[model samples]
Target: MAGVYFYDNQWFEECPKLIGPTDHSFWLGSSVFDGARTFQGLAPDLGLHVARLFKSARSMGLAPKETETEVERLCVEGIRKLPKTTELYIRPMFFARGGFVVPEPESTEFCLSVYDAPLPEFDGIKIRFSAWRRPAQDMALTNAKAGALYPNSSRALREALELGFDNAVVKDANGNIAELATANLWMVKDNVASTPALTGTFLAGVTRYRVACLLRENGIAVEETTLTESDLCNADEI
Candidate 1:
């Protein structure tokens, strides 16, 4: 695992800070966050990552402090702060502080923190069919990468793990497959690729976009359409 971390200029400190005595993010689950990576000494598709973060913040009505250019610079500088020879997983978040009682962005405080953790190795995942379905946009901020939505994912994952599976594949309210607990999913069929379109029920991931583009560039016809559990289990001979 790498041993370097990075954050914005605001949280560019030597030590971590305490948070969430009664934070709304902890209590009411009013927060949003996004993850992107840097590899081979460069952050691939960095601008898109930062843009998504801002989009996530706006989706949740949060006030993000850093511009895209500032975030881009900080990401690079953060890598420089780490040892030159180490591979790193860079994460940044706009969190809430003192965000209880009344959850207003003006009253909210924010910070960023990064740490060294191994990138997950998904050779293949054994997914369990989750009974816990995702909320509709009418009921939850399902489209945004909000902290509140994770509890459902966490519960589904915990249930799946208890049942001897690696992860949970949650369905939408109508019993359509949504995605894995964390990452978006793709199913290959007949030398072409297909994935669930970004309905209001799921976050369209940055990596997912890149992969689709790469596949399209390589002459594979990538289709954005709804996929079901049956579709995955029975993809035509590829």
Candidate 2:
């Protein structure tokens, strides 16, 4: 994909090889990243996404070298390098290069990649209930956007794809609906929108929060409560 990457105090037209096989992030998965999208010359919630990236870094015990303001500036700068009309996925990442089982906080390094990735059309997706469950907050780095957490989500997604579905609705350890494998789960019933309450098992995305706010502002009822598979099956929309 066509992109601009910022790494090691320089910008590259190509994605530079910044990590080795022995790097802590490569071997032990001590990495955190956040994604924001820029489309139609607008980037909504860019600051929230950037702030979450740093919060994730701190939760993963990595000390990021760039301030949140600096990271946001870099994202904007990277976005400017691409065509104004290009729909892009902007990602800022922090990874560790050293330490054994636990990553060395001082070994954290940061990079930003802005690439052409058009938003998918809303054709609606078919979803199946996955056998997998999200880890509890005490069981994993549930508070952070840590790289290690994605394997379970990928497994759920793969199983759904294999079963001829586009995505999977994953549940928490308590067997309540958590979210979709790729995004937050929402359902509409009698014009009311409801989603799973944030219980620390899944990441409550920036877009999800914004959507809830917008719905409420427009006089739509949005509820965050425990959801079950039966709720999904009975909903007017999902």
Winning model by lDDT: 2
How high is the CA lDDT of each candidate model?
Answer: 0.72, 0.94
List the lowest-lDDT window of 10 residues for candidate 2. Answer: 119-128
Candidate 1 residue-wise lDDT, 26-140, digit = tens: 7777677666665656667877877777787777777766676877677777777766555566665666654545466764444444445547775766787899988888888
Task: Write down the TM-score of every candidate.
Answer: 0.87, 0.99
* Top-TM-score structure, candidate number: 2
Candidate 2 lDDT (Cα, whole model)? 0.94
lDDT of 1 at 3: 41
Over 4 Å off, model 2: none
What is candidate 2's lDDT per residue for 164-197, written digit by digit as tens? 9999999999999999999998899999999999
Q: How close is candidate 1 to the true structure, as a TM-score?
A: 0.87
Per-residue lDDT, model 2, residue 66, is: 90
